[model samples]
Target: MECFRIDESGYTGFDLLNRDQRFQGATAIAIDDEEAARLIREYFPRLQAGELKYRALSRRPGNHPRLLALLAELLRAHKSVTYVCDKRFLLILMFCDYAVEPYYYERGCNFYEDGQNYGMASLLATAGPTLLGKSEFEAMLAAFQRATKEKTPAALKDLVRAAQKTKWRELPEAIGPLAQYAAPECLSAIATEGVTTDAALVVLQSLITRMEVMSDGPYRVEHDQSKNLATYHDLLCRFIGHEEEIELRQSEIASFKFPLKLTEVVQVDSKASPAVQLADVMIGAALEAANVMTGLRADGLDPEKLMPLYAEDQFIHLIPSVDFAEQKQFRRGTQAAEVIDYFAANFGPKK
Candidate 1:
């Protein structure tokens, strides 16, 4: 009897190479229909009449205090989960796709290689054509050829050259359907849109897992409809596994823990959906907190103070990786820096 509505924001580009692109994220607010109606009735009057957006309602100087109050209320509630990403970490999934492959298992994270040799270029070279198609794929490889004539980290020059020559005859039967469906635009979105779509999937996976322990019976999910996002979400759900039942070895997410069974997924406009609107606000606040601390050179806000503004032990997780960073030990000062510093020192250095 639980319904979760999804919303997202702060994505301007899907190109993985655009490191300067702003933070991208998605949020979901879970509630029953009655609760959704109650929330909309109580808050809609106070919000700007058009759309209850975080950027409009929270960012304007005049609205800052109201925005803060909204964020405070979001923290007080336990129904929301957010995934806000660092651009660099998301780009590195491409690298992960390479390092973890069968051909490169030996080069995967190890004592000496430390996973540096696995760059996104390898993944793109191998799989980019499946998404980007021949012409665009060739153009992308041409760009790589220019930047990395002699010094490509993952030794992607061979793959890039191969990708330029990729043909239907070369592609495996596994990729036939994708090759048939993928167009230039969809391929282009795989980067920027992938961040939000992937994060949303994680949220769905985690939330459903939590729901299994807290409730019983069926669940319904609603999302403010964006065609690309909806496409990604639905695709993951159908192909990956059931919300409640997943094969142990084949599971994309390791910690299944039995998410509440999802009976349906609905797509609706945000203007018509209270849960989606509220999810938008929460997602906005979460991404904004990260942006305030790490983005906006002028803000220079304290990262530690950011967590307490929400409910005790509940707050936005500004993660720099595909996997969520466990922040229970997130203390102020040096410790806060260390969370990211550890990844920076070990994983791909910032940018």
Candidate 2:
């Protein structure tokens, strides 16, 4: 069976609102053991006796070309995929999915049926920070994070309080309701059900989905050893033909979708696995490129310079994309223009 080596970058657990590491990424590469060693020996010859770490190599001047060359060689030789997450955007999605949608669902509304959820999330992520003020926006996310982490009614109430305090009147119509009716019980249910907002798991799921599509049959995964390995192992088990129901509310039961095909998942040391080391390099470069593109980090590396090496097909991002219809909804002088302007400046096709 085919084996895919995986490694992650910017792992801040479920803390999606982390300011320092604003993005998380994972890369999976499918290559033979011999070929992986060969590429490492050719391009990264100095690291032949040591582990290949992207951060260390990237810190030195004149190594950028070598890293890019190595990545290009790997992409040309192997089937590789990278999944990136805008962590703050992910928190916004969770807010819409867990808090907002469940409240509306209990009122006989399908928040996700017509892609309204995505639209709302896009608006909130882009404009919420500016409208609510950075402190308030961050407080709202911190409250939700505490609610999910603490899994207590009090913590849930704190989230509700934060929501109630949001300046929703100054924001879009789509986001106003969240402040008024975000259900504490629904938020509590997410925590009680042990649902995680981990970007790593999100990346793993997407990678597995793509890998399944690429594979003709069952495949194995070798991941860099991480503290969350046990959690990853359990999640992988559930993915293999397991079904569960999530209690979104007292009256609402949502069936969880498990779209994964797998045989095994093993966590190995990076020093021992050349493929995992390569995956580490791939994910680090990809995450840095994204951070530079989004203005999350100023690492002196020009994103446009790396655009040619950063193939669109090789990377998958969890960031939301608002359509033109949605963009036009925001009038020229309205508060919604903040959303439009943010997207126009930060997102879309990078030229």
Model 1 lDDT, full chain set: 0.46
Over 1-351, each residue of candidate 2 has an lDDT whose tens digit, in order, gives 899888777778778878889888788889866778898889877764488888888887578878878888787767778888888888887777666666666778666543566677787887787887767777888898777777777887777778777776677354445576555446654565445566555666567656765677778888767775555555565556443321111101111223344777877887888888888888888888888888877783456765576555676776766773643342112322222223233322225
Q: Score residue 255 of candidate 1 by CA lDDT.
A: 33
| TM-score, prediction 1 | 0.57
lDDT of 1 by residue, 66-183 (tens): 5565556655664655656654444434323321221333334221132222223334445656755757555543343332333342434343343344463344222222234332
What value does the lDDT take at residue 79 in candidate 1? 62
lDDT of 2 at 253: 15
Model 1: worst 10 consecutive residues (lDDT sum): 327-336
- Candidate 1: misplaced stretches above 4 Å? 11-14, 32-48, 97-217, 236-254, 257-260, 297-306, 310-351
Candidate 1: pairs in clash:
14-192, 208-259, 209-259
lDDT of each: 0.46, 0.68
Count clashes in each candidate, considering only residues at least 3 apart in sequence or on different chains: 3, 0
TM-score of each: 0.57, 0.82
Query: Model 1 Cα displacement at 65 (Å)?
Result: 2.5
lDDT of 2 at 256: 20
